[model samples]
Target: MQDREGIGKIMTETGKIVTETGKILTKTCKIMTETGKIMSKTCNIMTETCKIVTETGKIVTETGKVMTKTCKALTEKCKIIKETGKKMTETCKIAKE
Candidate 1:
């Protein structure tokens, strides 16, 4: 009887160990799934961010071109105004004489 009880106890302990191992494996599998999901989300975010940065760069380039053209136009207008002012002064001086 004593030997039988010892054998039964060992079998029960072995079953418990197997159950605990199975639970640990299930938990590890869940953790791996969650980690994969997080990695996928991070990659998506990075891809979107790169696209935004590329679009912003294009906008900045276009804006720079527009600003350069506007600056050149203003410079030409200022030169014209200065020349007109000088001509008007010359005309006034001649009339005064």
Candidate 2:
């Protein structure tokens, strides 16, 4: 009778441990599922950010091209004005002579 009672007690303890282990495994699976969802959302956000950055870079490049053309036009106008001034000065000197 004593041996039978001891064996039953051991079986009960083993059953409880198995139940606890099953609960732990279920919680771990839930945590892993939540983590996967978060990682997917993070990847989507990063993709959108990359697209926006690419568009901004294109706009900046186009704006730089326009500014370069404007600067070139202004430089050409300055050269013309300087040449005209020199011609006028030469005419004035000849008149004084």
Candidate 3:
């Protein structure tokens, strides 16, 4: 199993975003917000770190787009994502948005 628990982790489930000060320590741990995604290398936000409230590969934000690998359909977790009228790929939108 993936090691979700680390030196500063308390979560008991997978894909649970960690909001600790320094629990997150990689680029894969994305920072989600209303405006867009911040690929924070370290846990820098005041209270957010790798914190995806819903599920993995899904984001909670306003005016955001989280798409699938085909860039055609939005993931179920991203179905509510406001249509910014931007055609998005999962990786690009997550990084560029």
Candidate 4:
């Protein structure tokens, strides 16, 4: 009878260990799935950021070219205004004399 009781205790202990191990495995699988989802989201965000950066760079380059052209046009206009003002002063002086 004592031997049978010992055997039953051993079986009960082994069954508990198996149950705990199964629970641990289920938890580990859940964690792995969550980690995979997080990695996928991070990859998507990085891809979008890269596309935005490329578009912004292109816009900056275009704006620089436009500013350069605008500056050159303004400089030419200033030169024309100075020449016209000088001619107007000369004409007024001749008329007063």
- lDDT by candidate, in order shown: 1.00, 0.99, 0.45, 1.00
State each candidate's clash count. 0, 0, 0, 0
Residue-wise C-alpha lDDT for candidate 1, range 1-97, written one tens digit per residue: 9999999999999999999999999999999999999999999999999999999999999999999999999999999999999999999999999
TM-score against truth, every candidate:
0.71, 0.76, 0.11, 0.68
Which pairs, if any, clash in model 4? Answer: none
Clash pairs for candidate 3: none
lDDT tens digits by residue: candidate 3, 1-97 = 2453452354433335553433654333443442254434233563354454434436433215533333555453365464433444555778986
Ranking by lDDT: 1, 4, 2, 3
Candidate 2's displacement at residue 71, Å, is: 1.5
Worst 10-residue lDDT window for candidate 4 reads 80-89
- How far in Å is the alpha carbon of 33 misplaced in model 4? 1.4
Error of 4 at 49 (Å): 2.9
Please list all clashing residue pairs in model 1, or write none if there are none: none
Name the regions of candidate 4 deviating beyond 4 angstroms: 1-15
- As a TM-score, model 4 comes out at 0.68
lDDT of 2: 0.99
